[model samples]
Target: MLDDATKAKWYRIVFDLKKQFGKKPDMNGLIFLIGVRELGQMREFAKHEKMDLMHIATCKLLSYEGYYKFEHIDEEGWPHYSLVQKPPFTDLMSQENRLRKLIVDYYEDNGLFEDMDQA
Candidate 1:
């Protein structure tokens, strides 16, 4: 289970995202948004591309922890990464918590939070 602080940060993230985008985003949606931001392009992605975006988001998020390192961006503007180390977490809950914390970190790093006093 998420600790109280993590839960509060997660709630602020979702709330701010909804307030900005005019829709609530679940975990997958947040991942997708991160993928879009990383891609630096806003366009309709095909179903397969959507999956690829999520993969990119995963790699990018893990990269923050030094699990993955950015390799290069392809001619098509797709970023690639190499796995440096596998994630330390084994169980689903732990992995989710890690990702949640990473998401919060991402927002802070990007200065996306408007009123982070609550966070």
Candidate 2:
């Protein structure tokens, strides 16, 4: 289970994103949005392309923990990463929490929570 503070921050992020995008997004949606941002492109993605975007976002997030590292952006504009080490989180719950914490950290690092913190 998520602790109170973490849950609160997560909700704050959700609330902020809803206001910005005009709808609430689940965790996967947040990942997709992050992928869109990291890709540095603003266009509709195909179904498979959407999957690739989520992969890109996952790699970028895991890169924060030394599990992966950015290699280069491809000619097609997709960013690639290489595995530096094995991830420690194995089970589903642990993986979920890991991603959640990373998402929270990402939002906080990008200053997305500044106004939300005061509200």
User: C-alpha displacement of 103 in model 2, angstroms?
Assistant: 0.5
lDDT of 1 by residue, 15-113 (tens): 878887899988899999999998999999999999999999999999999999999999999999999999875798788888998898888788777
Candidate 1: segments with Cα more than 4 A from true spot: 1-5, 21-23, 114-119
Q: RMSD of candidate 1 to the true fold?
A: 2.9
Over the full model, what C-alpha lDDT does candidate 2 score relative to the true structure? 0.88
TM agreement with the true structure for every prediction: 0.85, 0.83
lDDT of 1 at 55: 91
lDDT of 2 by residue, 46-108 (tens): 999999999999999998888999999999999999999988748888888888888888877
For candidate 1, the per-residue lDDT at 110 reads 82
The lowest-lDDT stretch of 10 consecutive residues in candidate 1 is 110-119
Show pairs that collide, candidate 2. Answer: none
Q: Quote the positional error of residue 15 for candidate 2 in Å.
A: 1.1
Candidate 2 residues lying further than 4 Å off, grouped into runs, are 1-4, 115-119
In candidate 2, position 71 carries an lDDT of 100
